[model samples]
Target: MPTKTKAKSLPDGQLDHHAINEFKDVPIRATIEENKKIMEELFKDSSDIVLREFDIENGPKAMLCYVDGMVTTSAVDDALKALMILEGNAFSIDRITEQTLPVTQASKIQFYKELLTNLLSGDSVLFVDEQDTAVCLGLRGGIRRSVSEPETETVVRGPREGFNEHLRTNTSLLRSKIKSPRLKLKSFVIGTETNTNVVLAYMAGIVNPKLLEEAEKRISRIHIDGVLESGYIEEFIQDQGYSPFPQVQTTERPDTVAAGLLEGRIAIMVDGTPFALLAPFGFWQWLQASEDYYERFMATTLLRWLRLGSLFVALLAPAIYIAVSTFHPEMIPTNLLLSIAASREAIPFPAVVEALIMELSFEALREAGVRLPKIVGQAVSILGALVVGQAAVQAGIVSAAMVIVVSMTGIASFTLPRYNAAIAIRMLRFPIMILASIFGLLGIIIGVMVVVGHLAKLTTFGIPYLAPVTPVDMSDMKDVMVRAPWWKMKKRPKYMGTSNVRRQRPEPEQ
Candidate 1:
C-alpha cells in the first residue's frame, strides 16, 4: 500500500508541494472512489477541475475528468453520450478506446503522473470502476490566435506565414514546407512546474550526430521551474550567455526555421511562444534576411552591402563624430570642420555628452514606440524626436550637427536585419562613444578589437560563430560575402558538419 504524508503549507497557507514530485509515480487505483479522492486532494481549492461521474449503459460506473475551458466541452459531452449509449454488456478501457470513443486521438494511461499530464494538457480522461487504467481523449480546444504574418519579421517577397503559440500548429507548418520523412521533431517535456513541451527539429540524415547529441545534452541539463517562452531555452542552452551577439538565432517565421533546418542546423520551439530558436548561428546570418534569398542574387547582394554600410554607421557613426570633433578635428575637411564648429559653438556640453543625451533619448523613444499602441506609436516616436531634437537645438543643450548625426545613426540601426543584432550594436555604441571621448580614435580601435576577439572565440554547439571567415572555407563564401546565384551554390554550409553535403545537382553545362 502507498502511504500519504501530510504536505507542508506555505506562508500564504497553501500546500507547498504543488504536485511536483510527491504523487507523480503513484499508480492509478483499481477503485474509482479512491482515484477521485486522490485527484480531489491534488486539486484542492482549484475551481477549474471538472470531474463528471456517470454510468455506462448496462456497465460499470465511469467518470470524465478535465480542466474546464481547456478540453472542448462539446466533444467531451459527445464522448460521454457515446459511452452512456453503448450496447455491449462487457466493457473495458481498452474496449471503449478501440470501439466507443468518438475522438480520433485517445490513449490509455496507468499512472497518476500520466493522468495529470494528459488532463492538464487539455485532454479528457475517462476513468472506470475497477479499471486501473484511464483513456485520455484528445479534446483540447480553446480560443487561440489564428496564424498570421509575424509582426517582427516581415518579408517583401518571401512566405508571410509565421509561427503561433500552439506547438502542434507550428510543427505542422514546418512539416508542410519540408514534406519529408527525414525531417524529425523530437519532443521533450521541460519545466518542472509548467511542464512545457519543447520540440527539437532537425533533418535526421543531414544533421551531424554529435551536434544532435550535444544539443540534447544541453536541453536535458536545463532544470528550470517553468519555461514561458523559447527565450528561456535559448538563454539556458546557448554557448555564451554574456556575449552581445546572439549565439542562438530566434525567429517567428516558419520559413526562416525551415531554411535553418535545411542547412543542417537544428531548431528549438517551445509551447505557448511564437518565437523558435535556431542553433549554430554565424555572424553573417545576422546581416542576411529572408528576403535576400527570395530576390535576384544581384539585388540581394547590393542590399546586403547596403546593410553592411548601415551596420558600420550604426555602430561607429556617433563614436566617429565624437572622435573627430573632440580629438581629430585636423582630420576633417577645413570647410566641414568650420561648419561643425559653428554648429557646436554655443552648445553647453562636450561632444560625448551631446551624443549621449541624443542617443539615449532616441533609444527611449524607439522603445516607447514599440510598447505603445501601433496606431500612435509611429506618430508619437516621430513627433517626440522632432520636438525633443528641435527644442534641444534651440536651447543650445545640443548642436544641430549632433541632432543630424544621431538621427542618421538611429535610422542606420533600423536597417540591420535582426532586432537583437541591432540592440547589440546600439548597446556597444555608448561604450564606444565614451572610448572616443577618453582616448580618442585609439579607444574606438581598442573596443573594436575586443569585440572582434570575442566573436572569434565564441561558438554555438561547437560550430564557430564566425565560420567560413576566421576559419576560411572557400566553398561556403559563395553564400557569405556574396549571394551566389542559386545554380552556382551546390552545397550546404560546411561549418555545420552535415553528412549530406550536396544541395543540388550541377547546373547543366550549356
Candidate 2:
C-alpha cells in the first residue's frame, strides 16, 4: 500500500515560502518518494505512468518511474541490462553513490530539486529504497515532428534546416555554427503549472549586461499557469503593450538566432515551441536576410533597396491612389488622371470606397490561400486574384485603376523578410486609407509622421527601435542601407554595446 499524507494548512504566501525553503533541504530519496506519492494522488486517472522495481544485491531495492510513451523501449532495455544483467558484481546503491557513479553512461544528480526536475522532464529516475539519494539517467524520448524547412521563412539560397521543438536540438544547432567560448546559454523554468523550460542564449562578451539582466527579470516575473508558445512570453514582456508592431522578432532558423547572438543580441527558446525570440530588434533588421550575407554585396544591396522601396508601396500606394483620384488630381500626370477618371466614371462607389473594397477582397483571398490545403492553395490564390480582379472591373463594382493599385500593394508587402513586420504594415494600410478619404494627401502625411514619431520613441529593451538611422551612425550605416563586404564590416553595431568593436585587424598598409 502507498503511504498518503493530508494537506498541510498554511496561507498561500507562507505555503509557497515554505515550499521553497523545504525544497532546499529535502533528501533526494525522500523527495523522489514524495513526488511519486504526489503524482499518484494527482494523476490517479493516468494509467500510462509506469513504475518498475528492481534490487541491488545486499543493497536497497530501487524503482524506476517514467511515462510509457515518453521513453524508448530500446533505451530502457539497454539501461536495465547494464544495471541488472551484465554487472559482474552484485549491484549496490552504496557503491554507486554520487561520487562513485560513472558520468560516461549515467549522470549523477545530487540535489532534491534537481532530481524532481529530471523526473518531471520525462527521464526515468532510479530510487534506492533505503538510500538517501536517487540517480537520474539522462534519457528522454517523445514524439516530435522530424526536422523540416520552416514554413514561414522559406528561402531560395540558404541552409534548409529549421528548429524543432526539442530545446537540446535547437541549442545544438546554434552551437554547431558558433564554436566559441563566448557563447553562453542560461536556462530557467517558467509557468507554475506547466513548468516550461526557457533558455536565454547570447554571446557573453558581446551582449550588454544591463540589457540581458532586464530581459531576465522581465521573464522571471511572468507568473502564469502555462506558456504554450514564444508569443505568450513576447506578449507578456513587450515594451509597448498597446502597439501592434512586434518589439521582439521570432524565427525558426537556428542560423538567424546564432547570427543575432553573435551581434550582441539575445535569443529566447521556450519548451514545446519551435519559434525562438530575439530581442533588441530594430526596424531595419526585418529587411535583412541570411541570403544577403551569402550572396555578392552588389546583389544584396540591390535586394535590400528593393525591399525598402516595396515597404513604402505596401503602406501608402492605395492611400495615395485614393487621395490623388479624389482630392489631389493635380499630382497625377494629365494623361494618367484622364485614364483614372474614365475608369472611375463607370464605378458606383467613390474612389475611396472602391479602393477599400478591392483591398479587402485581396486580403481575404490571401488569407484563404494560407488556411487552405497546400495542393490547392497556390492555384486558388493565383486564379482567385486574376478572376476576382477582372470580374470586379467588368461588373463596375471597382475601378480598373483601384485593382491595379491593390495588386501592386499586395505584391510589395510580400517582399518583407519578417512576417511580423509585414503584418504591421498590412494593418496600418486601412487606417491610412481612412485618413486619406477624410483629409486627402495631408492626412496621409500626418499618418506617416505619427508612425515615424512612434518608432523614434519606441525602444526594444533600451536599444533604439530605429537605431543607426535616427541617431545617424555612419559606421553602422554600411550594413543597414547596403550589404558591405565581409572585410569592410570592421566593427559591430555601436548600439549593441559590444565590448570588442573591431571584427578584423587593421591592414599593414594602414
Q: What is the C-alpha RMSD of each candidate to the true structure, in Å?
A: 3.3, 4.4
lDDT of 1 by residue, 331-400 (tens): 9999999999998899889999999999999989999999999999999998989888899999999999
Index of the highest-TM-score prediction: 1
In candidate 1 the C-alpha lDDT for residue 462 amounts to 87
lDDT agreement with native, every candidate: 0.89, 0.81
lDDT of 2 by residue, 1-510 (tens): 974332332344122222222344445544345545644643469888787777655454667777777776678776665555424565565456333343334555555556556666777777766556677776688787787898888878888999989888888888898999889889988875677899999898788888889989998899887788999999887899888788999999988998888788899999888999999888999799878887899999999999999999999999998888889899899999898889888888988888788888888999999999999999999998999789888998988888888989999999999999999999999999999999999999999999999999998888889998988788899899799999889888898887667677788884
Give the Å shift of residue 397 in candidate 1. 0.7
Candidate 2 lDDT (Cα, 0 to 1): 0.81
Which structure among the candidates has the greatest lDDT?
A: 1
Off by over 4 Å in 1: 1-24, 506-510
**How well does candidate 1 score on lDDT at residue 126?**
87
Clash-forming residue pairs, model 1: none
